[model samples]
Target: MTTWRPDVLGDGYEQLELPLGTDPDGEGEISATLVRYQPPSTDLPDRAVLYVHGFTDYFFQQHLAEHFAARGYRFFALDLRKCGRSRAPGHTPHFVTDLSHYDAELDEALRVVREEVGGGVLLAAHSTGGLVLPLWLDRLRRRPGGVAAAGIVGLVLNSPWFDLQGPSYLRNVGTAAVDIVGRLRPRALIPLPKTEAYGRSLQCDGWRYDLDWKPLTGFPVRFGWLRAVRRGQAVLHRGLDIGVPSLILRSGASRFAPRYDASVDTVDAVLDVRQIARWAGCLGNRTTIVPIDGARHDVFLSTPGPLAEAFRELDLWLEWLDGADEADTSGSRTEADDSDDSDDSATVSVLHRLTGEHA
Candidate 1:
């Protein structure tokens, strides 16, 4: 049996520990943390939203949960093993040799969510979590009654790290080197230039996120982890049918700034937006890709203007999804939503004002 208790966010939130026994990466016992949002007056919806955070992140976005709750969704977020509230003493910070290891916690989390909601689930993820969930969904689609049996109805990816950003040589040559070195020293940290630009922008811009969990420069990238991410990307590039429609949100521009500047607040300082748009089609199924103008890597975290636009886009997509679900129940094909392809163009124009032709 699992138990829920008060969360660090205080009031109306609770967390549960999902023990997964010993770690396969040789880091001793390991477990994931599941946090729930239950504010008074908010009735639990039949469907729930399961949100997964990206690398170097956890479930700290309380406003995000409330937003879902307002739309009648019971919100649940996971802090994967060794991340945020799940990190135990002596355990490495977000270190995993294979992304598949996360399957255990994801399965457990879904089980709990279904047990409580008894309806369908809407998947939501940010950055790396965006990558991890689709991969897991692809695999899950082949098991037993398929993804629908697991109660997953749709997916929403926020700036998913699709292809490894940087020069082409890094994806080709550097990947091979990382794989070799990763096998030799799995925990070896990859040397990267440190910068507090993005983190500082968030802090000074009114976001009071904990720096200890999500550091200014982020946790050191390990060779083993890089190798795992590369493998995941390779698989994603081959294409995957997640067996559900997906909504992908990303920034319209990407700017790599070594230090803090004005651009850090509006553009994606992490993954390339073009890369996100380029391979987004590979996700298969009916996919809608929307670029939020002047948005950060995490569109929801962007400063006032872009952040609101991001929410607007999300609301529109969810409304469309709800309509599609109703159509499916009324003997109409859910693909009917595709008849309005013009909607995609209109949404893009809303963001393309600043830059043109991302994907």
Candidate 2:
């Protein structure tokens, strides 16, 4: 456990907490952090984006926020309970028995974004965050007038964990064994080594980022967390209808051996990229899969060459969504203009009225 300093993010962001009351099992209070990235203007943004970070990671991507801002979208990121900025001294980093536990934080965050920014939010999540959001959205869809079916307009997943990244036997039997161990010793640290090559490939070794936020050596993998992740992966395998346009991005290939070589720079050594492409169709009807050559796990965090390519693809996609001539799949030309008078204003006003007392 390294002592973390609060210099991980840029200057304009505020750390806000949401109380989740006592844990259902009577453990303690559960809370989450909301990191806001307000645009440099008073006029509300026509679009909003909510970013969720991956395991062993936090909302440190200021560059990403700038990208969204440049395109006229207000961006926000969440550091879920027990992860990054939200992690308390006694709590385990990234530990949760059920993925559903994130709903409380996510629901509140969405409400805040919808109220303050007054628009449909595009969800952008990476890795484990990718896994968590879709399932959360699915659950939200079941409830009447839930956040998932309401404010979210689309989803953008970067290397989503659609399934476990090992042999079938290991995914099944090994996961079961790990689950048993997790039940017995939830907090016990287990070995889940991260390769140095991947770290180097991302330029996050030391110079690029503060070590406290994203440790080069990575964080411990607890049994409880692994079990929870395995459970979530199983659900993703069954498929989800998020009921929105989705963009799935991944490296072209995967390399998973001990040797740290230049190949690590080109492919996703952390996860099975093929699996990302295969199950991508399961997301929804308007899903688009784009494979970037020589990209890392978190595509935006890739090296300069691959990173630029990823951004190019992202810009093109956003442009297309904005009703550009090149790729207008939505077939709605006035969508962006129509957003000015969107029904979201009424929703935002109501949410503001409901949450005004808390503010």
Candidate 3:
């Protein structure tokens, strides 16, 4: 059983501490945090969404929580071991030798959601998380009593890190380099882009987020970590059958200039959109790909124009999901009075603008 209490992101949210048993990094005992969002007036819902944040990211997107709650989803986001609220002083932030290691926490999080919400779940992931969940889901589908029994109905990926950014040689040869070097010096800091283009796009006053959690430059990338990411990318390039329908969203293009420029606002500064398009089909199940023009790497974080469009696409996908689950769903939503479908855009533009810095 899981005990819930007020979370760090406090307003009507609660946190559950998931014990991850032992740690491979010599950090004493490791654990992860799962944050749940249930509006004050609402009851334990029959519809829920379990979200996973990407590398160097946590669950601070309040508007995203609000968006789902409006559609009658009891939203929850996981802060994986060594990241966000679960980061211990001895732990290297976001460090893992293999992505599969996350299964420990992912399994527990799903169990808790299944027990509390008592209905099917929709997995929503961002960036590296996009890569993590599909692989995890593929494995679950192969299992007889794993998360597959918990009813994960659909998947939504936000600018999934399907492939590495840069020339073909870098993704191929560079990955090999990391593989060897990681064995010798796993914690070595892999050099990152000097330009803070993506940082600039996210740090503006329009989107009030904490710089502490999501730094302007980003956390250091480690050789072992990058190697693990490369391995995941290699697997995705081959192909995967997650066994559930998926929705992938990306910006129209990618901009990799070494220095900051205005293009940062209109294109994905973090990932190559072409890579996303190339690998979107690998997800197997009926996959829907939406490319929003002028969107940022995180479509929901884009400027008003593209931001609104992204939400619209999200609405359409959810509608499709509802139709698919129509046979089993009880079709009950005890939503708050203001939890209307039309609040998507207003939740992005208006509510996010009113968001304050993390205290």
Highest TM-score model number: 1
Looking at model 3, report the run of 10 residues with the lowest lDDT sum.
330-339
- What ranges in model 2 sit over 4 Å off? 1-8, 24-27, 146-149, 204-207, 257-260, 324-359
Two-way TM-score contest, 2 vs 3, winner: 3
Q: How would you encode candidate 2's per-residue C-alpha lDDT over 16-92 as one tens digit per residue?
A: 77677866423477777877776456775867899998887888888888888878888888988877877766676
Pick by lDDT: 1 or 3, better one: 1
> In model 1, which runs have C-alpha deviations exceeding 4 angstroms?
325-359
Q: Residue 216: error of model 3 in Å?
A: 1.0
Off by over 4 Å in 3: 145-147, 325-359
TM-score, predicted candidate 1 vs. hidden true structure: 0.92
Question: Which candidate comes out best when scored by lDDT?
Answer: 1
lDDT of each: 0.86, 0.72, 0.80
lDDT of 3 by residue, 250-335 (tens): 78777876766777888888888777767877877667676778999888888889988888778776876776653322222211
lDDT of 3 at 106: 94
Give the total clashing residue pairs for model 3: 0
Cα lDDT, model 2, residue 20? 73
How well is each residue in 148-203 modelled by candidate 1, as lDDT tens digits?
A: 78889889999999888788986798999999998899999899999989898888
